[model samples]
Target chain A: MNAPLPAAVDWPLAVHQALSRLGFGVIGYVPDAGHKRLIELCHGDARLRTVVLSTEEEGIGLATGAWLGGAKTALLMQSSGVGNIVNALGVVRECRIPLLLVVTMRGEYGEFNPWQVPMGQATPEVLRAMGVLVQRADTADEVAVQVDAAARIAFGGYAAAAVLISQRVIGIKSFQEQAAQ
Target chain B: MSALRRREVVRALLVNRGDLLVVAGLGSTAWDCAATGDHPLTFPMWGGMGCAAVTGLGLALAQPARRVLVVTGDGEMLMGLGSLATIGVQRPANLSVVVIDNERYGETGMQKTHTAHGVDLAAMARAAGFASAVLVREASAIESLRQAVHHGAGPHFAQVKVVAEKEAITLPPREGTLLKNRFREALLGASASLQ
Candidate 1:
């Protein structure tokens, strides 16, 4: 078998660069193990401000307002949060506000929660139906490069861009990993 | 204002000589406020509720010199009413929120909204910390928007009553995500100025 990936590569830096390329001065997120390092980087950076949201919908709203005020912004959440953001899609579809959303996928590849499966399977279809652009990252290296491209598509085209992180990239966070073994 | 009248008003505003920032929705009023050509940024939809004003607030906070406006629908606004308080606390002078109060979720269907009949939206804005708020129910909305943007200090709110109508306007999708790139560059430029 191949060797496990080293932790020294620094996923947070990659995510930070990706956010910068996406024109995000501020980002809204709901904390999760998949995004812990990324979230810390955003909070620590002076150029980037992190808005911790109570709900996924609030992050969407905050990103929208940031776009209007002349600052580029993005939302970081999990696949579960995508369920909470569906109704708000009408605002972006009608307004054409080009938002960049980076979501950590939960249901694919040894998912623990049954509730997250539907949204995970439907993510691409749902995004396409709403006219959003979606991309998936299976590795941290890909997350950095692909996210930059996604951000360009979002801002350059005035379209919403979504980056979905696969389970492999996130690894396991809790007892779920032990149970999987 | 009728739906058609609202469209005329928005169209007029866009055609006028000045930079414009608008928050649209999948509703009649949103189609009415549709913007064309190269805009700074457009944070399109993904079913997240109550994000229009919050996003608008972010942009306004970043770009103090630019005249930022959020053209949100009544239903969408109600999703994040708490943002009004957030806006109040931040006090972005360049920002103005123009709520197209048709009193219904026009895009999903003609479902009633909380503001379907004179729901004192302006009063709510005032309570949320806006220095000025107004309600208008006529075709003369362009002037009101302009006035609100010009006089907007702290946070400003305006409710424009419109008749319920839903229609789609076809436009080519924007390409390559220049909107986000430009926004970052703009923010960097703003940051440079602060130094």
Candidate 2:
């Protein structure tokens, strides 16, 4: 038999299964390369409904609505998208809605896109300021654990929680790399 | 066909609302909803101007057995215009969006919005792949719009044009948590506690 896939390659599946087990029926997101595999799994799952958002703030709204309707939901976004969600985060904080934000890091280590730096660097702080409990995971093995913790903090407590997956886990996509492709 | 009054349209829309859950955008639309008499089923945004439609989308998806209606003003709808594309693609049949288009930002001192400058929201909804979208400028059209809001096969969009006239504000509960808990209790009953 072929060798099992590496943990890095299998982490997306772990995250997906974790979300399903935690009872999240909806996944809302803006398109991001770092989340491609997770997004694909969300789309493929028969039990989950994937919502492609025009802006990340819309996902915040979706999460609030899902909570009121007694359904669980998660948001998957890139760090830059976190800036777009700041004002909308008020609903989650003030209303005490349970929210899970899975963010993929950029501009953290060996980042090529200069435009991503400001927001990426500010993401954790911004989320914290908005009253979101923040957790970081740098390796594939850490992802499932962090996600599980986040879900408990979010759903179990009716609070906002974020799991920021480091770029080291997603890999650095340099400008040169894109040009080569 | 002349534009219908905003308050009249809102009243008629909620006339036979039944078990429908309503999400109202900030400013005028929120006041309009409150004017209809507050209920636990109606969630009105006191802030977060552009979030109403997507909120309805989430409610629709979560409660497929229930109808979710979003009532928003023209300016608010313009601010969250991208949501139409998302809603169009998701196509939640139980959700409907109604834009009370006065063509001006009433809360911002009657500043003209994009709708006044030839931005057609109904057309945008149609182009974004909404199952059905219509612009209603006449009072006669309100009945058809009401039917669509309550019973139509939707993911529908209706732009109900109105005259830009200011009215006395009718405010809902200011506490977000209170409003949220009230709505949750109404919808989920004893299971409203988040834990």
Candidate 3:
């Protein structure tokens, strides 16, 4: 287990540093508000390639491909994206592909929208059922630290692991909140 | 011209393969690739339904020096049509995706796929901005496809119409881990044994 980086006290910055330190070759993600800052940070650094995916499930295949080509990879998505990843994870699991997923929660803890609830609630259980190790992070510092630890476990042993950034830490989304951007 | 043979098209593409990395989609395409000859560099998807193209895309992006090819059926290709859009946006010059369009789901009792009803996958790929998108209905044109796939500067796409007939089920090694590790070892050498 790795300790939280000095930058871990913050948020998206902390998560970004964790991925950077691990030397991830590729980062696959769909458009996500919770992951917007992190995704932007990972883009075009020369150290890694951040791919814009059509769907979350595509990220699973992308990660698998990267690994097979001797490159390390990770996926960033909202919990809703986890549902799209259900069948795709079977490839990663059965193939023993080293994978790390960083997911941001949307349905719990001050969720303004009800629709995100069903899939968000099922995210962890769904991943666990698919033979993925799940670790949830409730605080800003915990999120990146867990991502780093999970990545180590995954890449070290050719396993799949995910760090779910809890909704509380990711901040609540509302129409008014959208007013700023 | 009538439909071409699936195994022949796959065999033609893989003849002097050299260093081309292949990702075969589930069902018949996998069997077709296996029917030719099993190799460590060729990953036949026993499970992932529509991921072969994107999987090849990932490899293409990672190893920009190596050409990656994806062989998938029309049904599997249709299932992940969104991947074409994604590939279009990325446009890795080293990737080529070929759909063995039998117009039917050969593995599942020959149910007609979208291609059977006049769906043009090559046109879709062209719209998706592939450098080369051709619907190969003739064996004579396969030489050009092989040239484009192996040597052209492109994210290429070709939907080769094939006869919807069953071939011998040439099953490759089904163990995913072994397939993965062997591919890694072949591609990455000692580094594969490490992580």
Which residue runs does candidate 2 get wrong by more than 4 Å?
Answer: A1-9, A176-181
- What is model 1's native contact fraction? 0.57
Model 1 lDDT, residue B194, Cα: 23
Q: How accurate is candidate 1 locally (lDDT)?
A: 0.67
Interface RMSD of each: 5.3, 0.8, 0.7
Query: What is the per-residue lDDT of model 2 for residues A1-181, given as tens digits with 9 covering 90 to 100?
Result: 1122245548889999999898898899997777888999999999998999999999999998988898888999999999999999998888888999999988778777788889999999999999999999988788989999999988888899999998878775666654553
Segments in model 1 whose C-alpha atoms lie over 4 Å from true places = A1-8, A21-23, A49-72, A84-100, A128-134, A140-142, A152-161, A173-181, B1-55, B58-62, B79-91, B100-111, B116-148, B158-195
Ranking by DockQ: 2, 3, 1
The 10-residue segment of model 3 chain A with minimum total lDDT is A1-10
Quote the positional error of residue A55 for candidate 2 in Å.
1.2
lDDT of 3 by residue, A1-181 (tens): 1222244476778878888899899999987777878888888467888888889889888888888898888999899999998999999999999999999888777677899889888889999999999999987877887998999999888889999988877675576774554
Model 1, DockQ value?
0.26
**DockQ metric, candidate 2:** 0.77
Tell me the spans in candidate 3 whose CA falls farther than 4 Å from its real position. Answer: A1-8
What is the C-alpha lDDT profile of model 2 across B1-195, one tens digit per residue? 245899999999997689999999989999999999988899998777789999999999999999899999999998899999999999988899999999899997899999888899999999998889999998889999889889999899999999889989999887989988899999999767734
Output the number of the DockQ-best candidate: 2
Model 3 docking tier (incorrect/acceptable/medium/high): medium
Superposition TM-score, candidate 2 onto the true structure = 0.96
